[model samples]
Target: MSPDQFHDRMWEILQDINKNEFHAVAAKPPTDKAIANLATSTGIALPKDFLAFSQKTNALCIMAREELWPEAKLFDVGPAWTFHRGLVILGIEAEDLPEWANIQNAYESLVELYELTDVLPLLKIMGDGNHYWGVKQDGTFVEVFDGEATTLECSFIDTYATEIKELIQRQKDMCELITKRNKKQH
Candidate 1:
């Protein structure tokens, strides 16, 4: 799909998830200045498709759990979860953004930590802060696992669309399983 089409598809999926299952936060579109600043700060030429996406939503955070599960109380732990698992697409840093959602910060840190050359970090899968998908300076996509980078044949936009869809589906499946377990218990 074209970049614009991919953006529309992504928004549709995110909206569906937000309306039915979990909460999702999409930041406002970044301005030209913010995009330019990101490029200058990172010293990497941003991809055209990525630029198109940034224009739609500067950042996204989809919460995995909207409320605490009752099962947690059985484990003698506080009724609170320490971390959430979901998807994150880092975008240009804005005033309202959390530091973790800042693309420039993540890109620079990951590149330096991994000794990765000519790659730009973009997406964090499973909210692990370790697995990532990034664009190389050559305009190709790479998957980074535990700081190791592997080039993927698909374009950045296509990879983004596919991965996001898979993650959403996995989350839905897990939720269904939980519901089944709860029903059996009662």
Candidate 2:
């Protein structure tokens, strides 16, 4: 089917998921089974609505497709974000999935982004690509040609692992300071 055809059906299914009749997760609005059945039935490799729906609801997730995948729309919930000019959904995955995690990419991206707000000393990206992969170049966004979730893993686990940790600790400390100060005033 054409991209337009893909998008049209996608829109309908997304409306359903958002409307509460369908969900992506068994426990929540976007039930996994519902999403999978729809996607498979539609003949689309993956559901386009997953990203659109996520963008609409600000749904945080760590989705795995053909391995570990974290699409761009899902990963945008980060500080110092570098979006591709027109590429809506860039895919990647992160390794270290915490053994047992739910909505793995969403949780990872949310915490990962928040952690970087103040703690990242800096990122020096030096790579050759049209997208964010390999080494992060100044104007590039983290991207993956295949297995999107793996890209997330590489960014955080390989190149930026150290920075990711520092950012988390920094956020924790900042929160503690704020809490302490707030308690004193009250």
Per-residue lDDT for 132-162 in model 1, tens only? 8888787778898888889898766566667
lDDT per model, in order? 0.70, 0.29
Any runs in candidate 2 off by more than 4 Å, and if so which? Answer: 1-156
TM-score, predicted candidate 2 vs. hidden true structure: 0.22
Error of 1 at 155 (Å): 2.7
Off by over 4 Å in 1: 1-3, 12-18, 68-84, 176-186
Minimum summed lDDT over a 10-residue window in model 1 is located at 75-84
Alpha-carbon shift of residue 166 in model 1 (angstroms): 3.0
